[model samples]
Target: MGHRHKNKKLGILIFLVVCVLFLHYCTIHDVVLRHAIYRMLFFLPLVLGSFWFGLKGAIFVSISIIIPYIPYVYHQWNGFYQEFDKFLEAGLFVFMGCLLGYLSEKQQREQEARLKAERLAAIGSAVSQIAHDLKSPLMAIGGFTKQVTRHLSIDHPDRKKLDLVISETFRMEAMVKEMLDFGRPFQLQKTEENLNHLAAECIEISLPFAKSSGVDINTEFDPEITVRPLDSNRMKQVILNLLTNAIQASSSGKIVSVRTKREKQGVALDISDCGCGIKAEDQQKIFEPFFSSKKEGTGLGLAIVKKIVELHGGHIILFSNPEGGVTFSIKLP
Candidate 1:
């Protein structure tokens, strides 16, 4: 990579010098130089070169083509006209160069985004496989540890430590399973279902937690709308995660709202909480796997939710305002 970079720099430098020399030679032209049309035409290419190679390349090309014309700029009015024409021509070349450069830059960015998405997709598959492998063993381990605890004498010095291990292992196992499901791409288990029904179900399930946290839960759903080809269970999990996170982030007695409605793309689900908003710097990193600002947070919840939404041919956009709140708008097709 280092060598390649050096070579690129060297190549650009050589091209600049050669162009400069060529412009100097053009200035010495006799009959050919006297022709205004030919002289302006010569610099057009240089203008384009500047656009491609940036200001330096254009400058080099201009010197090569325009240096020849500079003397004529004052000598003959016809020559001046020719110079003006050539100046316009060079401007066009530079404009063309800029257009091309802008396109090239835009293309590179799209390619990078696509590649990143592909990489994340591949990693998701691998994570699913690893999570699957760990599930059975984790269950077995938990069961064995429980049995050991029961068989051990009540006064055993290792009891508390062993129980803690067992508890943590179970939690880890659940988290791993959650990741597997989130990253795993499965066939669309599409069925006709009511969007309002799903939202209501999730609310009921999460009510206990809401009561404990003192965060009020509000819901809005269109009952007449029908949405299908969705994994309701997975969608429920995503809602639960988002709402729970909101609760944790909010002060007691705050309000967290979940609203669902039909959009042109599909269904729009907005989950907003009147909690402390995520910091600007942290916002971009929020969806990264295993990243969390909360104490005792696994950090994988949002990552998993993002994957699940994407896999469903949907998108999740997060926004926060100075009102001290975060809103996650999920669009699903």
Candidate 2:
């Protein structure tokens, strides 16, 4: 796609250069009428550039046209009135380009936004149906596995195998729950809550996982950070999800840190890890639904986190740590 776009731009540029050269160099009788006809032709490239590449393209093409025309105008210096008229026409070319470019860019943005909305609607509907279908069977399988595991003696040869089955069943159930949560619309139940306390609680909840993974969890809460309106449960989910991901990404004996700090907007909750960081190419798509770097990830965790944060009038930012790993910052307003 990128290569195709580059090629298209090159073609347009070549065409524009050809048009400019023709206007300046073409030999014909009746110079004034000929120049007028070809000058009007400059608008074709201006319109094309504006529609294809927005303001920058329009401005660039207009400047390119004007530069060559300036030399031609000097060579064809007839009178003061003629020179003034020519310069006015050049100014009009730039003005037309700017206007067309602005309108084109606005149209493109509106179209993109509309398409994104339609795609998300379709995905939500499909995910809701699939999650609903899988929910009951997953529950049944998990229940039966648990019952069978209970019937078996602890030292039985198949006990460990049954436990593994139970574990996998639970994992699938969790994935299903993630899908359902993502498909549903967000309705934030907001109340004023301490950011520091919330971060501490999420860190505590993630402690067990961190320990089992041989990773250490750390926290730094700013004393000056105050309470703010938040959907406590949803916020907990966001924090826990981010913390768990950080812990999982970290190596043994590595540290995953959670911090809360006061910011100009409101407060920021940051989760940073000392593990291999995300690839630069994948960073932009990290929060996109069903886009994951993990082999077993459902890829909905970050998407849901972003949704919940935005619902509360906040935004999430991801940064690559200098030493290692990635930092996810939830900034609230």
Candidate 3:
């Protein structure tokens, strides 16, 4: 990357030098040739720079093209008509540079976004197939293990092995489900639901896991929350995934705080955990599917949460620091 940047900068410098030489030649030639060539040659660098290096480069080259013309205009101070014509030409050069540069940059961005969307769509299709193929066999294995475990007493020698098989199989099934969820379109069943009540319910459901991990859950909710239309089940899934992550990230004796508030325009939910905090690089890709920092993570939890939030016309904000921990804030309209 550094080599490419250096090469690009060198190319721009060479182009600037070439523009200066052209302007000098025009100034020293006949007035007719000077005016004709200036009208044509000066614009080449402006358009080229704009197309290559965008707005800043285009503006710089435009200024460089204009500076050399100043002395030429003063040297041949013919009349007001001549001077005005020269100034107008300069203005047109700058205008074209800015306009073309901006349009070129915008078009490039739009193209990049389109390509990214296409790639993600392809990935989703592939994941859907793979997850579907694995689900049926996984369910069968889990079912057989469960039946065998039920037949054996808890104290039987083989019961523990069967129980482990069942446990691992369920974990695998959950992972597969998450993959399917990620690869499918997020559909919400919306209803008018109490935000506070749903949050409390999820917290209670996670209590056993929190106790086993020796983490305490602290919650602060606004008393005057207005019931709003949302998908209660999907929202609960978001809460569960985040809470599970927080608890798993933190060590024993750490505290996880879940907070809810009624914003002026919408409702806000935040979950904070006192973990070691996410690394700088990891934070950027936290919501990207299949990008997980955890050894056992499938990397679809936060991705699915983000999809569900967007499906409901909401947004999520995240903050993290080693000293202060990580907080995920979800806002809904």
Q: Model 2, range 1-333, lDDT digits (tens) per residue? A: 298986788587768767666765875525767767778888888898888888977998887877776666677678988578877887788999999999999999999989987887889789989999999998998899888888989899999998898899899989999999989898888899988888888888888889999999888889998788888999999999999889989999999988888888788889999978999999999988999999996999999999899898899999999999999999998
Candidate RMSDs in order: 6.7, 2.7, 3.5
Separately for all candidates shown, the number of backbone clashes (residues 3 or more apart, or on different chains) is 3, 0, 0
Q: Residue-wise lDDT of candidate 1 within 1-333, one digit each (tens)?
A: 288874675476556545554554456445554454454454445544544455555555545544554555545446555558756865775565455555655666698889988877887777778888888888888898999899888889998878997998988897887667657665556677666787788889888988999888988776657857778877888888888887777788888888988888788888888987888899999998768888875577888888778888898989995587899888888
Candidate 2 versus the native: TM-score?
Answer: 0.88
Model 3 clash pairs?
A: none
Top-scoring candidate (lDDT): 2
Q: Rank the candidates by lDDT, best first.
A: 2, 3, 1
The most accurate candidate by TM-score is 2
Candidate 2 clashing pairs, residues 3+ apart or interchain: none
Which should have the higher lDDT, number 2 or number 3?
Answer: 2
Global lDDT of each model? 0.73, 0.87, 0.85
Clashes of 2: 0
Error of 3 at 178 (Å): 0.5
Comparison by TM-score, 1 against 3, better one: 3
lDDT of 2 at 282: 96
